[model samples]
Target: MKCWWEHLMHLPDDLSEMGVVLSRVNNSYTAASGEPVNTVQTVSSISNREVNSTDSEHSSVIPIQSKVCEPEEVLIPALPEVACMERGYVTPQQVYNLLNAEEGQPALYDPYYILVLDCRSADRYKDSHVVTARASVTVIHPALGCLISCIELQKYCIILLYAEYGCSPVGSVKARADAPDLQRCFFQLSDLGMDPVILLGGFSAFHALYPFLCTPRMVLVEPERHMLTIYPSEILEGALYQGSATQASDYRIIKNLHITHVVNATANCPNAFPNTLCYLRLRLTDDGQQDLVEALPLASRFINAALKADPAGRVLVHCSMGRSRSSALTLAFLMQHRQWSLLHALRWLKERRACTAPNLNFLRQLITYEEQLFGSRLTSLDDIRR
Candidate 1:
């Protein structure tokens, strides 16, 4: 949690004391000879004769609660209120910095959550935007739709909403006004484990405003007559970083495979390319992934092209580490193309790519997601192939 400064969004207002309680009791206490039992029991006691007035006329009793044991002490840091934003947003620079921060601060040392919502027209969302986006799509009203935002929150650490504000006509399905649905669409996202900072602002804010505010601990506020739309520029800034493993040894492998670009699966990576070679950041949140579930349709279009480019293009798909994310994506490709079943796809990836591993819990949920997709589409996995 130490490097949390890198991925947490700033609180719009300081509400630290609200909905929080902290208390401590020391080990020592003193009591008079004859004392009545009180509701609050005395934990410890110590006596000193210095203050005694050499007379029995008056006696004083100072009682204290239980003392904290030493050597083996309990340190319980408090958690924030249910509604307060705990983790921050992501950015491009943090990805690069994370790969090369000071020795004491390794990029992979800490784990952060990401939440992504698809506010785009329902159909367009079925395609793709940020690669790591989850698939928790529901309506603004809970009873009106099958999806729920709240449930998605239980699985991810951060959330991003991808909207198509002006892409469609005013009455069209994909207007920016669909923004508020992000909060309502999903099941209980406000539950215990959901992080607030990573909830991305309107799509435009992420695609446009973020790059400019890359410094950690800084905030950008859009002022209005009655309210303000504030963005946590720092978390996005610090979390951004360059693409995956840059060791010289890996360069040959990458070039041999003809990788043309790098797709960073974290919101923390820059959206644009750092150099002539194309690079993109897909600030994926677990919610978004829950929606899409599989990445093959997108990855095949992107990665296969790299493989077939004139000079040939190989691609590096990476998340915080080149593990779960890239691996899950690889599984998506197999599910879409190869005849392998979901279980087989995962097993093959793990066997061939040692670094390939999705969080076990995530994998379980993904299985359900895939089953739902298949259940709705093909009668079975076999039917999809034909």
Candidate 2:
């Protein structure tokens, strides 16, 4: 039976090749073919020349059976190996962070600009749906190519599609129970030479996790993203997050970051989730005259303990403003673990968070510590770019 998708969009329903969703992550827009998009004429013209050559010498006669019995060998062309989900599917937690700019992902600290396509029916969408998801009813689809062009799907860094029950892409390209909109959107992106991520477990799973984030309103003020933004700067990819007291106080930020350990470099800041998260609260202040040498061994021991407990665990370090104390502690940690010079560490910190400016005294202490560890003082605050 011809799939309904093949009828409407003239696309193959066999989504076996769809596993390339992870393999073909184009940071920018590019055709999947890796060539420029061409007109339908590029679809190989029907081969017209008939094969005339034949084994004429061997024809009209069968080879006599050899004394030794032998079996015929068969040859078959190899097919492409489907890529498994390495980082293809996005979880509800990750999606929330991607939109809010609070987790470890390609988006980093920036609020990921995304395009969300809701695959449910208009009525179902009207009831309530994921925040910032574009209802299928709101979209018009007279022409597929023109549709993507009108919406400028290429502009988004992340494109997400969700269904009602959240079926696997290999089994069902359609997003909802019986809707082609999701599959249509998938092909629309594929046609433009892009791969869109599927929301793991779909709306049902997402809403179950975060019911308050959904609403009946079809209008998106920001037009496809979360509202409130309070997240930490990713210092070391998925392993470490650096933030201020404000983010540390925000329970949402801590939970989303999956922070297993927290290094609190403040005398006044309370351990917000003491029962939940392990904290190494130093009796240090942001006065720039505090003793980091005394705190360094303690904090490093705490961090190493957590990693030993679970290597996949994540850690968060926060100070009053993530400027002086926290940044210094983070730098110290990097200097110890990453074997980076104070100069290199400062540059790396600033590259991720411009607010990372340890005070003059703190810089002196860091220089002294670096000199002790690596046997030389190689950096000054002046050497680092503003």
Candidate 3:
């Protein structure tokens, strides 16, 4: 008999023809270790994922997979990892998301979990810099070298660097003498395994968008001292929020975002604020075993209902980490509601979120969903490249 993946992923089916002792019993797949393997479609989706390969051409993730991975390891790149692999850049909005605090998550306090390094010239940095951001070169306080060595830099969850202007890519200026210190600071952090991202628009872009968040003071106000509650990611303009357990129980955040309806998209996470908010809990796991095709339309109907309820009515779709299950559901919603292809839907969502990575099996299921919806997976890896 053929391997389960051969049927599910539509692989060449020649792998089963190889000398392998693989058999499916009662719809259960077992690997060589005899462990009840859930799903191993990584090999089936490598052409679509972002990788740290030698070839820079396929370095970035475009949210479509058409290759495979070895059973021993999977290196699916989700930005900022994807961004790290090639662009070495991230949007300032993604930076704000990391700094935005949650009830149960790490604190961004005295020993800040998220470090913002201002990689500007000493003179420029001293005049004014982003609040809580340290200068790459020491002007007043510890320099970049001192901070990296003195502090447990690796402990920080998110690390960011920015220059005077970040509107353009660094390639145009990297060859210039005494250019911005963005490259040095970026590499040092990368060497430590703490993936750092250069702010896409830099200080100029950030300050313009959020003048209130930017400041000359290297200190935080009383309000800023405490971690800020996370606002949901805007999946669409119509008050739709894609989020996690962080904002699930925060009534203030929910109300602030005008999120009256919630789609609890996890098997473990409870329906927070059920009494106050409209709820549709899809008890799903983060793994690939659970099929999401049928539930996608169910979620679509529920989301539409909320929008129809009132012009101001909003919906929140959340799982535990707000990465896998929730991301998949959000992609499906776009495909069904906006009539977007899978690649188009994924791209739209990923632009707003760096954490929008659906697991491999969920990806296969989505492909099946697209084939059923639009007749075939006509969007190829080449298509995604274009």
Q: Who wins the lDDT comparison?
A: 3
Clashes of each: 61, 0, 11
Say which prediction, candidate 1 or candidate 3, comes out ahead on TM-score.
Answer: 3
Span of ten consecutive residues with least summed lDDT in model 2 = 1-10
Off by over 4 Å in 1: 1-257, 271-273, 285-296, 308-312, 372-386
The CA lDDT of each predicted structure is: 0.36, 0.59, 0.60
Candidate 3 accuracy as TM-score: 0.48
TM-score, each model?
Answer: 0.30, 0.48, 0.48
Model 3, poorest ten-residue lDDT window?
Answer: 53-62
State how far residue 138 of model 2 sits from its true place (Å): 6.4
Model 3, runs deviating above 4 Å: 1-228, 379-386
The TM-score of predicted model 2 comes to 0.48
lDDT of 2 by residue, 1-386 (tens): 10000000111223222311111122221234443221111101112211111112222111222121111222121222233564457777566555444323224323236667787787888899876677753443536343545346566788787777665653353433354666676666666776788778878888876665667875454423334444777766567777878889888877766778888887776878766776666657766456666455345545545555534668888887777888888887777666678888887777667667788888888888776666666676677644
lDDT of 3 by residue, 20-58 (tens): 233455545444445554332222122232211111221
In the order shown, the candidates' Cα RMSDs to the true structure are: 25.9, 27.8, 17.7
The positional error of residue 30 in candidate 3, measured at the CA in angstroms, is 48
